[model samples]
Target: MKRFLSQKINSIILGILVMISATLFLTTNGDATIFHVAKTGKDSNSGSEISPFQTIKRGIKDLTAGDTLLVHAGTYAEHFFSWETSIPNGKSWEKPITIAAHPGDSVQITPGGGKAFFWITDPQAKYLVIDGFIIDGQNQAYHGFKFQSGPTHIRVQNTEIKNTKYSAILVSIPPDYNGPSPNTYHEFINLHVHHNGSSIKDHGFYIQSSHNLVENGIFHHNMGNGGKFFQASLSGVANYNIARNNVFHNNSQSGKWSCGLILSSGEGNMGYNNIAYGNYAGLCILHRVTNARLFNNISYENENYGIYVGIASTENSYVENNTVYKNGVYGIFIGDDAKNTKITNNISYLNGNNSSDKNIGLQKQTGTIISHNLTSDPLFQNAQEKDFRLKEKSPAIDKGEAINLISKDFSNTPRPQGASYDIGAFEDIPQIDNIPPGIPQRLRLIN
Candidate 1:
């Protein structure tokens, strides 16, 4: 019996060792390290949870690929990064670095001068994640987060950037870059940008890159434009950029460009599942655009046109399944130069200032297809409360032609809930009363 007990104890010990090895492999993927930073800690000590670093710069100095830097709750002053800064130490796509705030902790990052808080100027820096930091520009800086040139696979999310003199975030390639390739695959998600562009004319979020994604953001109360996506003049031609599920409202308040979302020049850029309001123009497809697709959007209550596709260079565009209303000017404006465009499955109502202002103001041009459009009251759930959901028996419900591009609504609900697809950014779901059946008023027995 004693021998049997010894063998059982040995088996248990081997199982525990195997579990420990598996846990370590999954956490690090073999060669990663974890570091910590806090306000009260010292840079001289080892960057562990107990002995954290004092500043972000100190933590960044020691970060390599596959490393994780966890920052605690505090107010960070600034970190100066110039051409001489050795911040990016060979971060790779296979092993990216992560810098994030602790769960449920708030980190406020404020800059000191007229520069950005985080100036990533490295031309070859790639695969970095910056998440969960509140950046305040203090009205003395030009940018909150600026990537000067040539950074790809960079993801910024769950952050609030406000009060900057210029744009809250600026990503561009340097004009002098002679590289053969373009910077690509940048993603911005869940960002809140507001009250910027007072010092210089800019957008809330300006990106000059190709194949980027700007999703799930709130941009408002800016002096210049809301957001601009275009190509760099020297190095690359931006293409296949997408802006989805964002809310742009009350932007361009000082009337510089007066656009909520503007695509200056790009090819195959897409703007969908977005909502814009209280601006001069909700969505503007400006000069030199080709093969652009805009659908499943809602634009309402703006000072001017809801959607304006202009300039002589725009061609082969598609605008469908949008809900536009209550603007002071026309609902959708197509310039004389626009060609090969398809405008269908849309609902427009109560737009235009005068009786001559039609629901759609199409210029004297050919190559335009307009069909299945309704110009009646869409019977919104509540416009006063800013709720754009469709009411019961709304004309917009299940009245749209089926399209396979987007299978979901703005709220991520599955589409085609009824016989056909619904119009606008939202799908109408019939509300059900959960109360039990009431008793009959009078019941007579029949034989």
Candidate 2:
């Protein structure tokens, strides 16, 4: 009897070890093997180097959970997959998945294709990582990636996205089959959106009804809109987000209202330290939005207001320690029953019509604290040239709230030695040290 008991215990321990190994392998499922994408899997088999699958879609279909599908160097004109769920509808013994591009290899997904609904498989499969591919929107109406499901951890890193019709990376909660439809209230937390979206209309990534955080991303020339977050239901909170060091510029796509960074229809959120210039609107908050902070951002040279507050937006929306200049209209415009909103210690200057200088900064608004702001000329060495860095003796030097300098710095440019922090997106670094040679002076008549 003692011998029989010992054997049973040993068997249980072995089973537990197998389960743990499976879990670890699932999380780190990439960085091995080479999978090619052609037309079909049957083109070649044996999945080893001797004979690899031709297409990644086939490998994904035949793959179990914890599989990594690697695409080699080439261009794939196929529609890829449109199914929302990464988990196959019928598969059981599988794990989460990761698809990556081979190192030093480029996999291009050319668009103008089908209305493929889902791009990167299922959203329900948490811990899904898709990395290292060049996705070309090709002037098409489809998004580079369409995500649907509840992902505790989803990563799309080190990828280049260009010329997409909708958002390049789209994450949304699908119609919850179990509950009533439209139960999308969770956030896409810890998402790193970087180095994508070529122009103004090329939206980088959008979060609908998700309080996700995006960091270290580049959003350039996406004329449509940069990053968007909204909730269908207005009860929950989109809090504790950090958007820093991202550039939102050249979004000159002539839309009704284009915004650089926006926290619309969400509660308890923060949008700070972002550089939004040359867009239609630097930042916007509205539609029953509350408890949002707009701090330490530099918005300038846009077609309209640097910041606009829409109607029905009550208290807990604070705008402070920012620099707004040359916005073609009011540096800051408050509207639509926006009450008890705090706008303080900011630098709003060089604001007037592109045609005339009479209509200066700060348009008609109510319930705002427009205090301690220097309406005098900031005297940037070059405003229209995109050189927002303050020249020596510019009025913006030491022009901000002294309290904001304790922990954070909004100086986006390298400035002159012994020179103070300049207002706007760029810290006033000397052109000799920071500016590259022969980039052509881009000076303009901003004010």
Find the 10 residues in a row with the least total lDDT in model 2.
183-192
Pairs that clash in candidate 1: none
lDDT, candidate 1, equals: 0.76
Clashes of each: 0, 28
Candidate topping lDDT: 1
Candidate 2: segments with Cα more than 4 A from true spot:
1-43, 48-51, 61-68, 78-97, 111-125, 173-203, 220-223, 232-241, 354-366, 379-385, 390-399, 402-406, 411-447
Report model 2's TM-score to 2 decimal places. Answer: 0.69
Error of 2 at 58 (Å): 3.2
TM of each candidate vs. truth: 0.84, 0.69
